[model samples]
Target: MYRYDNYDQTLVDERVTQFRDQMTRYLDGRLGEEEFRPLRLQNGLYIQKYAPMLRIAIPYGMLSSDQLRRLASIARRYDRGYGHFSTRQNLQLNWPAIETVPDILGELAEVQMHAIQTSGNCIRNTTSDQFAGIAADEVEDPRPWCELIRQWSTLHPEFAFLPRKFKIAVTGASSDRAAIQVHDIGLRLWRDDEGEVRVRVLAGGGLGRTPMIGDVVRDDLPWKHLLTYLEACVRVYNQFGRRDNKFKARIKILVKALGIEEFRRRVDAEWEHLKDGPQTLTPAAVEAAKTHFPEPERRPVSDEAIAAYEQQRQEDRALARFVTNNVTDHKVAGYKAVTLSLKRRELAPGDVTSDQMEAVADLAERFSFGEVRVTHEQNLVLSDVPVDQMVALWQALDELGMANPTVGTLNDIICCPGGDFCGLANAVSIPIAQALQERFEDLDFLYDLGPLDLNISGCMNACGHHHVGHIGILGVDKKGEEYYQVSLGGNSTDDASLGKILGPSFYREDVPDVIDKVLKVYVESRHADERFLDTYRRIGIKPFKERVYA
Candidate 1:
């Protein structure tokens, strides 16, 4: 976790004071709604369906236990006694009073957190893989690079008001857990033959009214010029990206119109002057960023401990399933990354109660070095749990209703707040997610299906990232009637691909049946040991579409 310094602390404290004054003016009628719109948006406040929603950024999805406790306290005092974790790894308080938002921000500031850059058409939070440094397959930690970009993009005068919101993701792992390919700017970090760090830059990828997998604009960019090259790309977009239409204003639209080659050429020309400038990263700066993320202390586990874990697994089926689905292999031996499921039945997909949040904070302190991580799929991660304590952690999580054994399964759905909270949504997404979860509550059946990503979005804004799910459900409004559209074969991985629509949209009540039909087709057609995604990729979408529409 990155700690705040004097400069960082002062910056946030000052912003809170500034926003408080601005809000007072708005409430006092000195400022109209139209006049206060941008100011409030930049502070991460949105006027939703019923009340004001406040989105707080969890940078790169990292949080300390103390910070979690503060968030829980804020939720208890300000809003309803719960918070919804978003698909971008941010948290949203849906019922915050407009007048008291400043107080909420002040509380967040005490924990070195704030809502700045969480909204508005500026560079949003830079995200990375939740597994980051501990993932067994990671080449290097991408958090430092994410942090560097965060500092550079925050309140940058040059990019303060882009045509549309910009999102950037970095991944150093062979697996693309960060969904880099679908971001406005995606950086893949790797070492060259001489062992020097480099980046593969992808541009123009997004999912809204139009969905696209980013094109590779720069195949091999030296790590030293990371900031310079990024600046060049943004500069090109800012200058040429559409300003006439909000729907067409994103960088993805610009990349499509100009083509990848021309986009690259323009960026390269801009980079000529910026390369090796003072903004270019030096060894000392990179080292300083790395120091912010020191590795957690570890102790060696004896062979007897491993044997005991294996013995416990054989005796307890639920524990075995929890380990199989919720636990991931860590880079360090005798340790695992455990994902806490927030998608319990009867609740919204990403909603966490205040008590649950406090419980997780305590568990993180006791089991995982007082740190927690939020994943893009709307789950939390205790990234450094020792294998020896796995059983106890599992029991604690189960007691808190966080151990669902459904990570990467059909029941672990990614969903947006939809019409329930967001005014932009045409249909409700949470109920659909809950219906599907209830329909697929059988653990044995889910395990048999194997590693399915079912994502739902209230509308085409794609906040749920439905475009990249194995099975995507998008809410559509046909003459004010709510309908759900289904897509298949989408994925967010090393070989990222956008999902294809199966057919026309279905009625709201019909969506669960439609999903069941799609899964049935997959289970019948799949070869031995094939996942839903693998089966879909192998057999194409025709089989599932035929069954779904039949």
Candidate 2:
């Protein structure tokens, strides 16, 4: 985690004071709703359905144990006893009073966190793979680059307010854990055959109403020019992106309208002016950006440690299941990445109670090296868990109610807080998610079904990333009635694809049964060892749609 320097501390402190004053005026009738709207949005406060929702930034999803403890403290004192981890790798409090948001911001600043640019039409948090620094297959770490973007874009005069909210993601491994292809700007770090680092830049990719897989604008970009090239890309969008209609303001729409070739040409032209300018990332600057990250010390371990872990796995079936589902291989010889399942029957998809938060912090300190990661899939991670301590960590997490071995299963739903909390939502998402969890209680059945992605969003904003789920459910409103729309064969990997909608929307009550029928077709029609997505893509949507609508 990057420690805040003097400049960073000063900037956040000043912003906190400014926002407190702004909030005081607004509450005192000095600032109108229209006048205060942008101010509040810039600070990541939204007047949601039930109360004010304050989104706190967790840059690149990295958090220290101290930060987690602070968050837990705030959650216990301010609003509810829990907070929701969102898809942007941010934590959101759903029930804060409007007047207290400034105080919340102040608390967050004490931990070197803030909510600036987390909302409104500006570049939001720069996200990356949760296992960025520790993934076994990684070629380079993307955190430094993410931090550079954070430093450059925060309060940037040029892009303070774009045509619409923009998102950027980066990944450094062979497998795309960051879901980079669906972001407005996706950067892939790769080392070519010659051993020189190269960046594959993709532009115009986004979900929401107009979902798109980004096009590759530059395939052989050097890492030194990353920021400059990004500037050029955003500069073009800023100049030509649609502002008249909110629906068509995203860069994806602009790229579609202009075509990939023309968009590339414009970006290239813009790059001519900014490519070698002051924004070019120097080697020292790049190294400086990376310096703040803590690297776990590698130590040699005897075969007894390995033997102990294997013996534990053999002894406990539950431990074996948890390892199979939630544990990931690490780059180091004696370490593993463990994901804490937040999708349980008792809670909303990403909601973690303050008690759970503190427990997770404790586990991070005991098992990992005092660092935790917020994943895009709405889970928490201990990235550097020693292999020998896996069983102890699992036991603690199980007691904390976060050791459900549901990772990569249909029951591990990625859902947004829909109509229950969000004003923009057309219908409720938690109930639908809860229905599925109840309907699929058998863990063996889900594991047999294999790596199925089921995501739901309250609206077309795609906050839950429904567009890329293997089975995507979207809420719709027809004459004030809540109806659910289904899509199939969606994927959010290196080979990304937007789901195609099945015929008509069904009533909320019909969703579970419809999905059951769809899964029945998949189970019957799939080849041996064929995943749900593979079967869906192979058979196409006709069978699923026919079964779902029947």
- lDDT tens readout by residue for model 2, 94-162: 988888888888999999999999999999999999999999999999999899999999988889879
lDDT of the candidates, in the order given: 0.93, 0.93
- The residue-level lDDT of candidate 2 at 308 comes to 85
TM-score of each: 0.99, 0.99
User: Candidate 2 local accuracy as lDDT?
Assistant: 0.93
Model 1 Cα displacement at 309 (Å)? Answer: 1.1
Residue ranges of candidate 1 with Cα displaced over 4 Å: none
Candidate no. 2 TM-score: 0.99
lDDT of 1 by residue, 218-254 (tens): 9899998999999999999999999999999999999
Please state every model's RMSD to the true fold in angstroms: 0.9, 1.0
